[model samples]
Target: MAARPEPMTPTGGRLAIIAGGGRLPHHVAEAAREAGEDPFIIPLTGEADGDWTGFDHEPLFVGDFAGVTRAFRARGVDRVVLSGGVRRRPDWRGIRPTIPFLFRMPRVVSTLLKGGDDTVLKMVIDLIESAGARVVGVQDILPSLLAETGPIGAVSPDDAALADIRAASEAATALGRLDIGQGAIAVGGRVVALEGPEGTDAMLARVAGLKAEGRISARRRGVLVKLCKPQQDVRADLPSVGPATIENAHAAGLAGVVVEAGRALVLDRRAVIGTADRLGLFLAGIERETMA
Candidate 1:
């Protein structure tokens, strides 16, 4: 059985939510606000988009790597609630990098290329902390958002689907280690889709089409697996699942989801699990090493 995480206790301090695109960032920001913490949001250019003013925190655009650090400093951010999709690649083209960022880019990119996600992001966290701030989990400030363990829904995979789940889990973790992709969809023990820059929904939708076109051969529904890259810095980001994940899985005719336990997050746990249950999607989390 997967462990059910407890709701977070409110830790007081102004939390700077450095947000990027995706539901998780917004979820964290909302969770922080509901906890009565002073929530500030900084939207990374090309990543986070929404009504900034409604969040009740001033939104600043930080593009270059150096600008991000300065943005936090300017807002008196002592602790940060790091959340959502800050692209590792997409933001590079147009960035007007500050001098500091340019000087550090070689080291950062070198780490990314030669090391795992953990290696690359740890360098980043080190950079942030060196600038006199702390980086903490979304759960630290938003405990209720942690994903709980259990069967989320009624419909689990049939025997063949379970096989696919197992295979998908293995492949997904391997890919994560290589920094290839976080998610992979498999049918009949073969990879049908591996998540690319377009994200999970796109991956699922495309694989569903492939299955319809007779490219995949699973007798039952497909299986989807997302993983935290092995050696990833847990403090910064982990692969996440939520209501949206389960919904997308079902739409793609998938039977279940497998994420790295403790290393992955389930946002809106109750609603996500309940929806998965209602939709007959199996939800499971695993440790990265053991599962791999």
Candidate 2:
């Protein structure tokens, strides 16, 4: 396991959210507001799908490192929280960096062209820090979003589901160690699907397709497991689940869903639990230490 960076204090200076598509960013913004801090949102153009009405924000392209730096300086932003889903990586040849970023462009290009998601995120964090802003995870701003150990709702995993969880959890951890992805699915104690660059929803869709085609056994349902990568910088890119996840899991014909306890985020907790319970599926937060 990798040592996580010490959490940065949320106090002092203006806070900014480098937003992407999904409800997580909105949740962070709302939490910041509830804490009496007005968050400035920098929604990535073409990537941020949520409505930003009434929130102070500016839109920027994903490759516009220079623009992001300028925004940070202009807004006096010293604390940044990265949230939501970024489906696209910038086109290397099209990146237009300036000033300090101009000097770092070579290294940035190398990492973007050669690195995995985790490496890319680390590079982004370094850039944010270089601009004098400390990067924090969504969990830091709203600890309530962190998934706790045990069942999340009315249902608990059966023995068969537990076995699938164990198999999938190990597979997820292994996949993360390689910086491949954070999710996997197992059926009857056998790994059946792995999340890739395309992400969790798409992966679940693939499982659904397999089940529909009669590839996966209709009688033996599976389980989806998500965990933080062994060497991940938990300050960013932690595995997350939400109502959509439960819906997809049900659609995928899975028996349950499991995530690393205290190390994953559950977006819209009530909705997630309600969806799981309503759909007759289990949602569990399992500690990695107990997986063995």
Candidate 3:
């Protein structure tokens, strides 16, 4: 494993997390607190799943730009982090834009209707920055969560598994370049599945179904790979893996999983390692260029 990088010092002013579904926002909040900063959380309605009982938090809908801006300004927030999964986009008609933003509503609607995930995220970042807060990536707050180079757990990929990894990595990169998805699955050096809007979990489930039906070779194990988009902003939606990922990969009859080192987030690191080890699954962090 590569050595962990030193933690970054939090920039001046209060930190705010635009939290969505999952433990990631909570993790970021904990990291911010550990760094001697109290973080205010704006949990998206229906999207944020965890209890935010102890943290200073406010609930807002997905498209409440005016409310989010007001909350940031009220709490003297200058650094904002967007984390976790948003399963669905908000309805344009339901969005509450600020006066200035309202003027740009036409463009916003157009982008929402026609743009890919990357384009939509860039627009969101622009809107957040326009509200006078700097949008930061979860990586900026907790560098240790990033996958380091080499094996993440005890098991290591074999030659065939490594070949699968390389194949899936290339496929994932292409998928990302199209602003489509971040994950791909391969078996015996043949790409089998590419993640789409339904996400990695659903994609893996598809693979499992295919395997069960004797479509993909039941004899040969596969590998799953996740990578950053070629033109991604990186601050909003970096690929993430966790214990669930290991479980899913095992269920999918995969031999291993690989993610781009330093570019993907590994949630609940110890748990992920334990799960990977228990399941006898190889979890490696590879450099994309090295694999190429």
In terms of TM-score, which candidate is strongest?
Answer: 3
* Candidate 3 lDDT, 1-292, residue by residue in tens: 4455576586778999999999999999999899888899999999999899999999999999999989998999999899999998878999999999988899999999998899999999999999999998888889889999999889999999988988898899899999899999999899999999999999999999999999999899999999999999989899999999999999999998899888899999999999999999999898888878
TM-score per prediction, in order, is 0.81, 0.95, 0.97
Q: Model 3: runs farther than 4 Å from truth?
A: 1-5
lDDT of prediction 1: 0.70
Q: Can you tell me which runs of candidate 1 are displaced by over 4 Å?
A: 1-13, 54-56, 65-67, 87-102, 108-120, 288-292
RMSD of each: 3.3, 2.6, 1.2
lDDT of each: 0.70, 0.89, 0.92
**Residue 6: error of model 1 in Å?**
6.6
Per candidate, the number of residue pairs that clash is 6, 0, 0
Q: Please list all clashing residue pairs in model 3, or write none if there are none.
A: none
